[model samples]
Target: MNKKQILTGFLAVTIFAACQQGTANQDKAKDGKSISAGAKVPAAPDAAILTFEKESYDFGKIKQGEKVHYDFKFRNTGKTPLIISNATATCGCTIPEIPKAPVKPGDEGIIKVVFNSTGKMGIQDKVITVTSNANPEINEVHLKGEVTEP
Candidate 1:
């Protein structure tokens, strides 16, 4: 076949294959059952809810190199158990401890956070983010204070 004829044939085959592939995919999509990106799934009737009595604490002024701690009190107000999956602090100088076991419904819990002023100076604000099986899934607590020279 001449170069022009061969090129035309190749182009025709490529277009035909692409057209077939497109139709096949479209048909499969129409026949298959799948969840849409924005589809709303059935929510839990008895979900875990985390309610905090206090979300922020002020440790006030502390000497540099001193350590201060606070306990953030919370309760599980929902019907299901509250399981904390993770707790993280914005700075390494701050450490947060979560409940190792699940907090049952109507039961109270505490998240203890310790802030070390060793290397931190001046106005300090440490944030702790907690993730759990609670309805909201995520919660935050703050620790504020000032570190002065020792």
Candidate 2:
């Protein structure tokens, strides 16, 4: 073959090889794999962490001498089991009920709050303290609303 022809053949072969290499790299990237690029991945959070979906409750408007109840649902988003030690209301007029057992990861639980507005008038605010194994350890949930006079 002429020198010009040989050089043209070499260039075509090199281009083909480069194209094949690029296709292989794309396939590796498409395999749904990930790498940290020499960095360590963060450890999963503890399983026993109690995380509430909401931080507060609004009771809206209620008449005096009435009663209301609300349930706050939560999920165990950590990697360990979650345990709620206790739940306390801000005042005697408000009652809170917390889960009694540990909640496994991806599981759900509830916290129930009952408010008695017998003697309360106008707006009322209450809080429920939740003690758990969550990162912050202690969480305070709040309840607020207006109690209109009957």
Identify the candidate with maximal lDDT: 1
TM-score of 1: 0.73
* Among all candidates shown, the one with the greatest TM-score: 1
Q: Write the per-residue lDDT of candidate 1 for residues 1-150, one digit (tens) a residue.
A: 899999999999999998887655532223365544444444477999999998889899999999998899999999999999999999899999999999999999999998989988899989999998877778998999899999
The alpha-carbon RMSD values of the candidates against the true structure, listed in the order shown, are 6.6, 14.6
lDDT tens digits, residue span 30-144, model 2: 3356543443333345536667788888989999988989898898888888889889987899999888888888999999999999999988889899887776677788889
Tell how far residue 133 is off in model 1, in angstroms. Answer: 0.5
lDDT of each: 0.88, 0.82
The 10-residue segment of model 1 with minimum total lDDT is: 26-35
Candidate 2: where is the Cα deviation over 4 Å? 1-47
